[model samples]
Target: MHNWNDPGGKGSACQADKDRKDATRIAGQLNIPIHIRDFSQNYWDDVFRHFLDEYAAGRTPNPDVLCNREIKFKTFLQAAIDLGAGCIATGHYARIRKHQGHYQLLRGCDPDKDQSYFLHTLGQQQLAQACFPIGDLRKPQVRELARQAGFATYDKKDSTGVCFIGERDFRKFLAHYLPAQPGFILDTQGHPLGEHPGALYFTLGQRQGLGLGGVQGAHQAPWYVVGKNVTHNTLTVAQGDAGHWLDALRLLTSQPSWVAEKPPGKSFLCTAKTRYRQPDQSCQVQVLDDHCEVIFEQAQRAPTPGQAVVFYAEELCLGGATIEATDAAFGGLEAST
Candidate 1:
């Protein structure tokens, strides 16, 4: 067994140490020789650079996905191989299988805890030597098994949200790396509603932290981020529900990384999720020379760019790509001013 604690400077040191200790105890109980690797600076710099680059490009990035691909699967996997290990297993709620002489990635039995979305970047080579020990068990069952085994983490609360941020203010944490450029918040008609800290700080369908109170002329409804003009440093918001802006039937994604090594054909049908924990939606995927285009059976909500759009066929995870653009428009957005 091996425990990889990324000892990046900042607040992660404590968590890394705690996790290492836990892994150590578990290894001792299981009577297995444990290995530890400290991937501090390289892992931190690579992931942080991607985060800043995405925000600068006016898009929200998924660092967790990159972390799993670059660090957990790539770096750590290689390290395990160097240690003469034939296969590497993890606690991730994902399953890998071999079918017809090819490796395949599958969703965990626990639907709510399935992590196939983040593991979409994995290829056939990696899946061939990977294992998920607890993929068939639900969270509660896993916890119960741990308790029966006398493990201290049996009741540990599950972690969520951005890993590095912990419980800190997201805006403030981001400002440290990407300095905010305050700009005017405009309505659909290009009327100024208020001032926002930064256009990059907000995303489509965002409702909270807009800081806009009741405007005398505008409707009393709460504001929602409808659009953003990143080039002009302007954030477009709309009063009342902003559901109209999020409706999109089609989206274009960057070069997709298919789990099977390449796409099945020129065009194929599949279900996809543009964000983590999102319910799978039906879609038709058209593979293009430069990118992939997705036409959903029903209009999707908030298909934000810079996030990953993972494709799936039933329980099998096909692959994913970074969303580059969406054909969604803000036509129905009403602005009193």
Candidate 2:
């Protein structure tokens, strides 16, 4: 098991060292020689220089996705090859299948826990050397398998917060690096209702904790966050009408990975998922240069930017991309374009 704990900030080296000590101690007890690589200083100084700089300027960065593609798969694979290791393994829940003469990446069987979407940025070469031991199993089956193998982490609570950086309150974490700016909560029609602590603390589909007191409609029903006008520092709220959420979305993704022998011409039908936990929805996928457009047969609510959009056909994962934007105009099946 490899633990890459680089938080991309000052004093991360010390933290990484402490984590390594703990990991080494545990590995010794289990008679496993675990290799712990400390890349904190290098990550902050090198791999994430631009992202860290952007965060310093108050921009949110998806460091987890970047780490998987650029560092763990790219740099670490090279290091492993140099060390005479033929394959690299990870805890990612994606699958690899041999097609024709090449390996292709696919979503795991557990739809609720599939993580292939975040891995779409990886190229064909990385997929060839990657191994996901738990790809074919469900969450419960994985736990049972771990228990049968006498692994203590069988019952371990799922880790939260940013990957490797450990747990932290979302606002507190961002506040450590970015300045907090208060924002307003507004209705779909632009009526001010309440205030939010910061724009960065909220997401496109969030529902609770807006601190909006005078929210009038849906007196008994809960409200959900439908959208956010980042430039104006305003959040749009709506009654928990599942119908008003989302139906279709257009994404602008960079560095796409295709598992197909040849790109599908014009459009093709596939099972698409906007979020990890969501069941695969029927949709038509159109691959474009630098991006792919997904038109869902059913409206999806609050398709947030920076999240992944994965596609599947039966058991094969065609590919996926980051959701750059969404449109509510296609709110229902009949409204699809």
All candidates' lDDT scores?
A: 0.83, 0.66
Would you give me the overall lDDT of model 2?
0.66
In model 2, what are the clashing residue pairs, if there are any?
246-299, 246-300, 247-299
Q: Relative to the unseen true structure, what is the C-alpha lDDT of residue 322 in candidate 2, on a scale of 0 to 100?
A: 65
User: For candidate 2, what is the TM-score?
Assistant: 0.80
lDDT of candidate 2 over 251-273, digit per residue (tens): 44434556653555668988877
TM for every model, in the order presented, reads: 0.93, 0.80
Query: What would the per-residue lDDT of candidate 1 be over residues 206-300, giving only the tens digit for each residue?
Result: 98888888666876788888788778999888778666766778788896999999987789999999988899999989999868988888878
Error of 2 at 322 (Å): 1.5
Query: Candidate 1 regions off by >4 Å?
Result: 1-11, 330-337
RMSD of each: 3.6, 4.3
